[model samples]
Target: MSETFDVIVVGSGAAGMTAALRARDLGLQVLVVEKAHKYGGTSATSGGVAWIPNHGLGGSTDTREETLTYLDAVIKEPVNRERLEAYVDTGREMLGWLGGEGINMISMPWPDYFAELPGSRTDRSLVMPPWDGRQLGDKFPLVREQYPRFKLFNRYSMNLEETFTIAARAPGWKKKVATVIGRYWKDRSTRKMTKRDRLYVSGAALIGPLLARLDHKGVKIRLETKLETLITTGDKITGVTVSHLGRIYDIEARHAVVLCAGGFEWNQELRDRFYPVRTSIWWTSTPQGANTGDALIAAEKIGAATEHTAEGWWAPTMILPNRSASNFEEVHQAVFDVGRPYSVCVNRNGDRFVNEACSYDRFGAAMASDQLATGANTPCWLVFDAVFRQKFTAGGILPSAIMSDRSIPMDWWDHYIFKADSVAELARKIDLDPAKLEDVTRRMTEYAAKGEDPEFGRGSTIYDKTFGDPTCQPNPALGAICKAPFYAVQIHLGDLGTKGGLKADHKARVVDGSGNPIPGLYAAGNATGSPFGLNYPGAGGTIGPAMVFGYIAANDIASRATNRDVASAREPVAT
Candidate 1:
């Protein structure tokens, strides 16, 4: 006999889980299925920040008009205005309701990615408070582990605040590090079970609480369950055909089926077909072998339309050589560090292109454009001097004060940061013309001394200076790169995830090619066409809309759904 659910949510990330939880709260029986062995998907590995404008939290003074103006200014592609409006209004409600459900979030003063825009603000991003992983008991092992870059020494994890504090070596940073290590050591009980710490931060923090809440609400999440196809009755998506432990079964959704199975960033065929440029999956920071467009493919087979297939949440990334597994390689996101003092990203021609201190998405877009135009900027070099290395981290290496130049493993020299005694030698090692490289370096040093960037306006915005060194004389973001022992690390255009997939409406209903919502079908997160289009509004831009729309989808279904059970119209085609 087949099982029945009020709602069947595919994928177990924030969007799927939030949809299930919200549906359950509306008195619906929900079943969450995950393709991977663990829950949380990419959300568990992300920074776990949600950007909610006018949230009225942490004294945010954002307004609806301001947010709308800002989105209009920043988002260039065509978007459903209703979805944008719904996000601003419903996002606040989601935050408050989640808090009431015990998912405590603190407002982060992280400025919008486009700080110069009219509607941009500094107080809208929210992050979950760090929680104890031990609270989840044996289920702790079921959650996906955070990326190594988010942890110190690949062991103890730190929240965003602590990460910034220690990275900048700010006041009391020593005490903070000591306290973190101390806490990890004190958790002898957890230590006995596993080397993983008791403290859960970032995406883990948010996911941990959500899992607990789902368990309390009696939500059943089937791990290692793969959705083979959406079982539809006419135009209505009635349920799903899923395979588990080599057994195939039909689970009927009495009301609706929500697809939140994430983007196709990992699928090479999809990337070659849809992505604009830089089609290498190795350049991405998302989880490997996951988010392979399962839901997108299944829905498209059922007549769902896709948009923004060429866009992604662009970011600059460096592929590290130190850590290598059988199939996986370490990728360090150069989001903030490249914006700090004494560094510039240059093409093979040794010319400074975009402002090194611009928002990462913009930086990535610049790289993509430059590469497409010139064909020499795809694999760029982030050039810096010894002084810069001493003050800030580059690639995946820590600051010299902590990791030191001499103590660095010998094998990492060329692969990680190509070290040379002078700018000319560094240029020669990286296959750039020595004279042009030196000329660019000299001009950049002059800009640093003048406290201005006439070429690219490097140190001009609040967004630029957010990760800069305040103690640097004059412009905190500008500093001389004239010191000897120069270093350059290769950077690639990377992304948090692909931002394109199945198109959906303001109410989270998946729309067909003719722009009509498919009955009993819904979608959200990276799996759907991003409501914000190619523009990233602020920190947590990717995950924020995902959670909000997931919440909206559940509510929309609850409002219109009836308790009529539909029999399967036809046999589901087995894959």
Candidate 2:
């Protein structure tokens, strides 16, 4: 027997949930199937910033013309102008709809990754307000928790403001630290009693309330259900064959099948085929076993067109040995840490390739571009000094209050962290030419002292300074790597996820190779060919488009259904 729903949403991330919720609001029976045990996909572990331009949040003054102009400046060829326009125009409407559903949101003051871009605004991003996990009641356990390393002391989840306050050593730092500890203790007590922490922020906060809303509406979400294939009638998708707990079930979609399943970051074969630089699951920050591009493969099997297959939302990542395994590894994205004072990334030839303070996407892109020339840009070394170790956290290693033998491990120093007492010795340890490395180190030291990086212009922009130490003079990002006992960690090609997938039209409908919409198929989020093409416009670039297109898909499906019902009503009676 086959179960039937007005809409079947594949994947349970922000995109899938948004589609399901919108469909349910339109009086449609919606079913969401997730391959993972938990509901939220990568969105659950993300920072939860939605880059909705001209959203009017935080008194943003962004305009549609400005946004289009910015898109023209950043996005590349094979661009879908219609889809991009739709996203910019309808983004505010989607936010309004979500807000009406009692989902609390606040303006995140983070600037656009490309603040210098024409349409960029500092207050364009919006994030979900902190949520109390206890409100989810029995369902709290099923919600996938954020990665342990992302939290403070693996206990308290801090917001952007709190993170900056502590990192910058702002006024009342002691009081803030005490408050965090106190909250962690309270959370510990709650966890002991109920087996779930109460305070949820970032991605958890974004997803928790949406899940709560879904629960309130009695929406059916089947976890551990993997989509095996799409059941199509001619060129139109009608249903899907899915396997749940080793049991295969055929499910029918009465109106539409929405694919929000993630991209192919975990699939090595696809990475080798599409990516400019070959990558692996070991490098991505996405949730384990979640984004294998199953949906993308399924769509391709039905002749769905794809674009931007060579691109990903890139970020330089460092593997943490303590959290790695044979099949999977935990990756810490080197975002703010790399841009802070006392740090610089160098290729195998011991040369700086890019502005270290730029956005992660640009940083990774620079590394990939450099690899095309020398083939040795990846596995690049992130070199830093004793000052960086004493002042900031990097790759999950926290700053030490007192420098001692116990503070720095012998095994770590010998294996993961290459340490040397001098620049020339550090070059020798890392297999770089002593003269070249020393010269680069000397130049960096000179730049740091002058607070100017004429070579790469580190800390030249507002976005760069956002992650830098405010205490640093002239340039917050530049610092002399002259301190003794310099340290280095291997960084690799990492990403949030691949941006390319099944090509989608303006209505979020999956388009065939001939450029026609496949009747009942739709895709959004990372599962669809990104509307941004090659450019990452803002902080929430991935999630923003994912949500807007998901909403668009739902609205289009709902409108089509209404029109069909109207046509059927006008049909002549059989005589």
Candidate 3:
């Protein structure tokens, strides 16, 4: 006999959790299945910000018309207008509902990636504040954790504001750092329980609370349960065949199946098929062995349509060896790190390509375009001088003042970062033409002196200046790379995750090529082609729509159920 539920939500990321929560609110029996031992997927490792425009949180002044106009300006590809409208309306409602349920979200003063675009503003992004993980009790261990690099000393986590302050070395940053560390040490009970901090921040903060609420509602969430296939009766989805402890069994979904299994970033075959750029799947920032597109593949086999099939949430990643384990490598997305002054990313032929201070998606797109044009940009080089090394932090490499170049492990020097005394020497070490690199550096020096980039307009936008050094003279993002001990690190064309998958409508129902909804089927998150197409609007662009659509899907199902119930009540007595 199969266990039955009104809604079966696959994957336990923000989207799935949101769907489960909403379904339960509508008086539905919800079952959430996660493939990993942990519940939250990539969301747990993410920044936990949601790009909810006009949410009225944090004094936001955004309007629906303005927000739509902004989307029109940024998204180049065609998308369903209804889906766009739903994203706007449902996003606000979903976020507001979450807030009322005590899943508190605070707006961050983050500028849109395309701040200069029409309808763009600096108030759409929202992030969860820090929460106490101790409230979760034993369930805390089941929550997915952020990457080690996101934590301080691989133990304590910091909020967005604190991270920004310390990274920018803003006023009272030292005191803030001391307070955080001091407070952690003073909590002797938490330390004794686990090395992980009781104070959850970022992705964990969002997921932790959602989990607590779902538990209170008695929603059953099974971990290490892999969805093998979707059970279908004709054109309608009935349930799913899932494997748990090597036993495969069917679970009946009485009403609907919500596929929120994230993107296929970690799946090599899918990446090779859908991604236009030629790069290893290992370059992705998502957790390995997760997000392999189980939902997408199963849906596709049943004739579900796809869109935006050749893009990702692109970012340049620094490849590094694990310090504690040399045999393994770590891929860290270096979006903010690249925007800092005194650095320039160049192709293999030693030519500066795109604006170094542009948004990460644009920067990564530039890499793809450059690679397709010249085949010399996939493994691009981010070159900087000793001044930059001293002033800014690189991936896994602290500022020289904090952890000097000499202090970095020799293995990094051997396998990752390249350092030399001059631009020409650095070029030689990285296998680039010495003269070409010298010329590029010479041009960069001129650009810095002029406080402008005539080639790519590096520091022209508010978004560009967000990650810059305000202390720098003239343009904050422009600085000369003339100091000795120049460095170069190879940057791979990497991504936060793949952005393409099964196409979903405004109601969050999976649609076919004919634009008809696949009855009893739904999808959200990276599992669906983003309604915004290729555009990444703000800090939480990925998660915002994901959660909104998940909420929409649950409500849509409940609406159908409500109508059926009303119809039954109206039926004439047949007995």
Index of the highest-TM-score prediction? 3
For 1-575, candidate 1 gives per-residue lDDT tens digits of 26988899999898998998888777777899999998798999999998888788866778888888888899988888898899888988998888878887888878898888898889888889898877888788889989766787779989889999888777888998998788888888888899887788898888899988888777889999998988889889999999999999999998899998899988888988986675588888888889888999999999999988886788888877645442445778888777778888898888778988888888888888888888888789999998888878886777898788887767777866799999999998999999999989888889889999998998888888877888886888888889988999988888889888999989999999999999989998999988888878888988899999999999998888665222221111121
| Residue 400's lDDT in candidate 2 | 56
Per candidate, the number of residue pairs that clash is: 0, 0, 0
Please report, as a residue range, the 10-residue window in candidate 2 with the lowest summed lDDT: 566-575
Tens-place lDDT per residue, model 2, 1-575, is: 35888899999888999998887777777799999998788998898888888676656687888888877888767688899899999998998888888985678778788877776768777888778887888778788888877766666677767767876566776688788667867666576866345777888888899888887777789999999999998768999999999999899998899999989898988889898776777888888767998998998998998888887898888875653342344678776777777888889989889998999899888998999988888889888888888887676566655334366645566566778898788889989988988888789889988988999888888898888887787788888888888888888888999888889999999999999999999999999888889888888888888888989999999998852332321222221
Clashing pairs in 2: none
Q: Rank the candidates by lDDT, best first.
A: 3, 1, 2
Off by over 4 Å in 3: 562-575
* Stretches > 4 Å off in candidate 1: 322-328, 564-575
TM-score order of candidates, best first?
3, 1, 2
Top lDDT model: 3
**Per-candidate TM vs. native?**
0.96, 0.95, 0.96
Enumerate residue pairs that collide in model 1.
Answer: none
RMSD of each: 4.3, 4.3, 4.0
